[model samples]
Target: MADLVVGVGLRDGVGAAAVVTAVRSAIAEIDASPTDVVALATLDRKAAELAVVRAAAELGVPVLGFTAAELAAASVPNPSARVAAVVGTPSVAEAAAILGSGGGELVARKRARDGVTVALARTV
Candidate 1:
């Protein structure tokens, strides 16, 4: 089985439950088991966010953090101009997952819930 990476995007003060929900939702959307996930990824700025940290710990994986510029360098199937205006990137979850997976294929598109967003990519 190919290893998968889950990339996260969240607003400030998000709860761990919400993060968990988003991750589960995204992975489920792609019909992948939790064991397929190797790690979680997100903006370096939010790497230390308790929600993300807690969610990664809960998922039994380390969190890989990437800078906004690094995330912006990636090309995503779905890019949001509004997200770019806010965080200087067209996408956070999709790009982070792509970059974290070594430019791998996006297995799942972005999904939002309870103030969090998640996407999945297969490791190259």
Candidate 2:
């Protein structure tokens, strides 16, 4: 399986450009073959979560959502038959652990300005 870091923002903030930027950033950061990132979308839409689930299914790249509490607390159901990882701001570390537990790799933003760096560990 391949790994990708998707930056999910508010629909207002997550426009086509933002999604494109996130996907491009992820692709550039990972530097892997066979593009993994499908599309990074914002969570402003009720269907945003669904979009993520569908993309994850088709691309087989684990979809991760990063946002604040207000969005995270949304009642959107997890759509993946397979376990999916969702994280909130300041919870990047926690998301990394979840990634490990799910046999998925995490591209976590370590330094303040260094952007995200990929980290791999065995899950299950």
Candidate 3:
């Protein structure tokens, strides 16, 4: 099985439960498990989001935070101008996943629910 990383983007005040649910659903699409996930990635601005920290703790994985410039450098299938305006990156979930996986392939695009967005990437 491929090693996986999940990137998350969430609105303020989102809870860990919602983050976990969204991640589970995203990885489930690829027939993967939370145990298969190596890390959770997000923009550095969200590095201190309590929900993200809790979700990573629950999944037994590290949380990787990337700067907007670093995330922007990653090539992603989906880029959002709105996100860029708000966070200085066109792609948060997909780009963070790709970067956190060390240039892995994006296996899943961003999936949004309950104000949380999740994307999956796997190292080749």
Candidate 4:
């Protein structure tokens, strides 16, 4: 099986419960387990997000933060103008996942729930 990377985005005040729920949903779509995940990625501004940190700790993976420019440079299937206006990135979860995977193929697009978003990618 291919190694996977998961990228996450969450609204402020989101908790680990919501993050875990969203991540589980995304990985389930690709039949991946926590053990299959190599890392988690998100915007650098959110490096201190407790939800992201907790999720990474729970899954036993490191969390990587990407700059807005790096995330914006990634090609994502779901670009959002609203996100661009707020974070200077069109697609946080998808872009972070793609970039964090080092040009890996996106296996799951953004999956959102309870103010949390998740996407998965696999290195090719």
Candidate 5:
């Protein structure tokens, strides 16, 4: 139950605001606290995406990015228990699939607070 900041990347003029809204809505559907999730929808650009990542890093929140179907390549700053901020192609199904895969162990859950819900999977 680690707080996950999910970022969605879309094409230019793809209504990033709408996408972000949709992401937030989807996050709400996950049945968790709103503050536990930070959804950022942005256009498919390096600088724009980096800014989002930077902000999340500053906040000490684990960042995740969704582009379309697959995850795009980006270097994320690993501060504390912060894993790589996942950047994938924008797709609700894909996003769900990615998240459902048990992304990884909760390295760091909250920076501002403590007692974060951590989710992890063990591979055989």
Candidate 6:
């Protein structure tokens, strides 16, 4: 398991470079480093997104995916009704990070770049 889990939210057709940059930036936002991250997480439907898969491969981590309803159930610091309308969950990056950590505190809030969003959570 990861000491820190990285949650990612990205649009279709996004590039791997953007995903990598977003994740790296989020990791940098907190005290943790990339090595502390063990997995990248997102909505299950997006888990196989080309950018997501490629980025995780480049980062040397696996991907953990959750269903929309599962993500909706997770409490998050930031939520958007617009996101809920589109993705069926108000929180993706933040909630996925929290859930990926198997219930932990958010270490870094959502950070977006080039249409990719990332959040970090420290495992309990």
Model 6 segments more than 4 A misplaced: none
What's model 6's TM-score?
A: 0.95
List candidate 3 stretches off by more than 4 Å: none
- Candidate 4: TM-score? 0.95
lDDT accuracy of residue 44 in candidate 2? 29
Worst 10 residues of 5 by lDDT: 115-124
Instruction: TM-score for candidate 5, please give it.
Output: 0.36
Identify the leading candidate in terms of lDDT. Answer: 3
How does residue 58 of candidate 3 score in lDDT?
94
- For each candidate in turn, the TM-score is 0.95, 0.37, 0.96, 0.95, 0.36, 0.95
Candidate 6 collision pairs? none
TM-score of 2: 0.37
Q: Which ten residues in a row have the lowest lDDT in candidate 6?
A: 25-34
Q: Please count the clashing residue pairs in each candidate, in the order shown.
A: 0, 0, 0, 0, 10, 0
State the lDDT of candidate 2 residue by residue for 2-115, as single tens digits: 434343332322333333344444445556433544333233232255534554455455544434453333333222222134333333322332332343334433221222
Please provide, for model 3 over 14-121, each residue's C-alpha lDDT reduced to its tens digit, 9 standing for 90 to 100. Answer: 999999999999888889888899999999978778999999999999999999999999998989999999999999999989999999888899989999999998
Q: Model 3, 66: alpha-carbon shift in Å?
A: 0.3
lDDT for each candidate structure: 0.90, 0.36, 0.91, 0.88, 0.34, 0.90
The true-versus-predicted C-alpha distance at residue 98 of model 2, in Å, is: 4.7
Better of 4 and 6 by lDDT: 6
lDDT of prediction 1 = 0.90
TM-score leader? 3
Colliding pairs, model 3: none
